[model samples]
Target: MKNVAVVVQDGAEPFGLGSICEVWAEPYHPDDDNPVFEFVVCTAEPGRIEGGSGFDLFVEHGLEALETADLVCIVPKLDFRHNDPRAVAAVRQAADRGAIVSAHCTGAWVLGDAGLLDGRECTTHWRHADELAATFPKARVNPDVLYMFDGNILTGAGAAGGIDASLHLMRRTFGARAAATTARRMVVPPHRDGGQAQFVRTPMGQTEADTLAPLLAWVSERLDEPMPVERLAAEAHMSPRTFARRFRDETGTTPLQWLTGQRLALAEELLENSSLSVEQIASRVGFGNAATLRHHFAASRGTTPQAYRKTFTCLEEQSA
Candidate 1:
């Protein structure tokens, strides 16, 4: 997408707007070829807009800016209950014109108000998922995901979820290379597995010391080694069954699930930062072989290892 218009209204959340700007508004990259988006902040009521932090921002553009945007992003607002009809109409118009219409946090409410959420699969910040679903009965809300993209309409959960959704859109539009460049510049992971479920659950235990933090660290360090539940249980000094129970209690996920996630993360790091072949990365991350890595990587990341590497290889390394 060439042009991006961020819809900001009164009570806009700074972090949400900043997240959009970080991904789309940043100028050209120094190391890689990346698309530069013409990012503009537009409001239904132009001029001074109040932010959620009680700060006032002078927005120069009106809703008219959204008409020419290739992507229309709605920044989170303080109250999802109150939405301006003018802002809602602009969102609807943008969506009707086939521009990607995305929302961060409670911004989904604006899409709902625009009647764009009807019969579409979407998500909002978990705290507001129920209300979003109840208010828009036709919209299918999956609360557990970090983000959901249905057609050209995308929605993210709260806070950092906006970053995740924005990166995803970048990857979708400009290829993984550009997205990885932006992510590296932002110093954020290019992709994150799992969902808001990990955040919504109460801490596995009240005190950090009450959980198996040590065991987790140990396992992370030895991800290249074989780690069956039996080995992990032994490391934790508990029976296999007991270890499994405590693992779920401590991490909100099973031992295998956690290990696979760690391996995948390491694999992604290797793919982006190293020149290792797929088979070599697979061996380093305990996936054993290129075929196995391809299976798991595609299953978890929706892209093959070779393709991912090709899209995310460091530009410096490429020239060298």
Candidate 2:
């Protein structure tokens, strides 16, 4: 069993806290045995810790709970850049003692404030993401995933991504079957690959909400089909000249630009999720051949498709 510590502060949201507790609060009996973790919840002081919800969260333990932890998990705060120094100090001490440090959601910002996130891969709630990347260029800021595990320091994306982060920890700790079993019991997906892109944005175009959504969706769904300016104008029910003007007005770019983004999105998904050859991906994503796909993938992502897959693929390799 692992000595796991969950560190919380004022105004902590229930979702993030509850998600961690849901997984760690109990034990799973393999042979109808006891719980697997010796879980501890610690706040700055004993008694009640006020959370985002109306109710006050009471954790009997204090910072001392981290002293003997084999793994110390930081519950994300609402505003990490301005958190108290003592909270930051506890984080440092836990990491200093060789404890596996984990941060969930905007909790990663606390690790960032503690200076432990430097030179490591991390993610945070997308709202504060620009500041995190701007503040710490040395750290690899992956704003796209549910979580990241760079060695012992694991950082999760947004609040909901806590499930993915915790499940990832289980996968590494007890193996795939145990993780899958826990997920099934909890009624969550076994794994979510790619990034928070699938979670964050509502796809390439919800142009219908504004003036451009339908036009964008129509073009995206037919990537293999030709998207001529005149043809698109007809879809929008406007003359070619008027359509071009409205397209720019609504999306702030020409129709072709939006089309490029959608195609690139598909290309990346195929590369990360499938064993499809570059040529096949290119065809599916509207690019004519491997050369075009390679050019765009390298230019936009700074790496080839093959290399990206090797670095990010999380599932077991398919057997022949």
Candidate 3:
């Protein structure tokens, strides 16, 4: 994960490109001790690349810049439906050679254009998710997630979800500490538990007073305690049925499902940083027992808690 190449082209989204650069293009600082990346912003052609935001960028590298990259990122563009054949081929080839390839927002279109999304579970900005699904029928488009990774291909939802995906890669390749350090530097949350569904617009027109954020924060602190929908509804001062409806509207998942996800996230952090026994962690995270924790852990992560801890600890040690 040391070498990274970001593929951009004409009509590039400035914020998307800048987000990728912010994460991977940092110079080594003695204080941070984070691994530096050999980051190159390449295009299919070297020279003036027109931006979607009425500006132009001059790029020096061609598709060849991807040859030795450990990670290849596709930056979103306004005209995402059309992509250069050469750039698409380069991205496909990069994935073929075992490099992790990621697409941010509408950049999933490039992976789709290259036939890389076939039979893969992927996502993009919710606005374009339907179009992407329609265009690539073979791709299983999950429009609700902030980010998803199927094998070597990573796809992020819209906007700040790019930061979530980037930090996730860092966490997986390095460790929780490294990811947290990077996130602190960027002033973003190291891990965001919910999906992009929370950000999608709705006809109901939700306001700050209607937000469930405060209740979520309160629940997050008490994950160790049992929380059924009725209890949660009472805490929110809503009936169980009304609470269920609003919970899905705001979080894109049911209360139990969302709680499971939160518990899994907390379990991961404990697995990475704590020396507690698995049973202790399970109890702390509201799973009650190690068996229940292992079941959900295997379902969500495709690995057991013990194996996950071992892998994270090994990566952390290697990075250190």
Candidate 4:
């Protein structure tokens, strides 16, 4: 069995650490006695580490365990301002000696700090994309995706993106079935394509405060028409300024940002599932032109719509 080591610090997030154990350390199944990994969750002190949201974690191994690990994982911390070089060095050293180094969420910053992300493809929580790119200019930051795996070095966004990264690692190591089994045990999708964009801001028409959902549905229906904010505000029954503020509050972004995201999603679907041309897709998604859609897709997805479609487009029909 390949050995996996998860590195921890004083202020690591529990979800990331717990995800390491949940997917890597635990047995794959009771009846299936074949186990794929011998996992270790190690920290500097092998004791208690405080986490975000006031949770405390206890472990039994320390940094010494990292030397023999086939894979090393770095989990997120409560504070991003201080990622000790000692921890970063250990991970770098492990990677240098042929162990795959995997960092989840904000842990990508540590790898960047260790200088491993230079000229490499990496990703992190969308909120930290700017800071990460500015801090490490050589590192290519792709903010639109769920995760990016460049050879052995892997990164993920915040929240449950850690799970996506973990499953990705499993897929490469054990095969797609093993990855799917582990994801089922954890109740997560095993393979959400890394290219999928992050959450978009929209006046979701749904009643779940997705004020943009309805407007967006309405917009999709009328792709030939301009989805101006004033028109959308009228649909939402609020003044233009008030509607914009409410949309931002509910979606963590502006109406235009949300609209652009929806258009991008539509473009991707049209590219992957349909045989639509770039200009046709642009018009269908409301960008109305290939050039305009290309600019927005590049801005929002960090890749061109043509490239995305070429990479992700399905070749055949699915069972479902």
Best by TM-score: 2
For model 4, the local distance difference test gives 0.78
Ranking by TM-score: 2, 4, 3, 1
C-alpha TM-score for every candidate: 0.64, 0.67, 0.65, 0.66
Clashing pairs in 1: none
- Candidate 3 vs candidate 4: the lDDT winner is 3
Against the true structure, what is every candidate's RMSD?
8.8, 8.5, 11.0, 9.5
Tens digits of per-residue lDDT for model 4, 57-127: 78899887889998898988878758877888888888888788888678898899888999999988877
lDDT, candidate 3, 179-259, per-residue tens: 898898999889875576544433211223247888887888899999999999999999999999999998887989888
On lDDT, the candidate that comes out on top is 3
Q: In candidate 4, which residue ranges exceed 4 Å CA deviation?
A: 28-34, 193-196, 202-320
Clashing pairs in 4: 201-258, 203-211, 203-212, 203-213, 204-210, 204-212, 204-213, 204-214, 205-213, 205-214
What RMSD value applies to candidate 1?
A: 8.8
User: For each candidate, what is the lDDT?
Assistant: 0.86, 0.77, 0.87, 0.78
| Model 3 lDDT, residue 215, Cα | 85
> Candidate 1 lDDT, tens digit per residue, 1-320?
78899999888999999999998888875576668888899998789999899688999999999999999999998876899999998889889999999997999999999999999999988888999999999999988789999998999989999999999999998899888988998999999766665445322213232558887777777888999999989988899999999888877788898888888888888887887888899999898988988887777665677776666677887788
Candidate 1 residue 201 Cα shift, in angstroms, is: 2.4
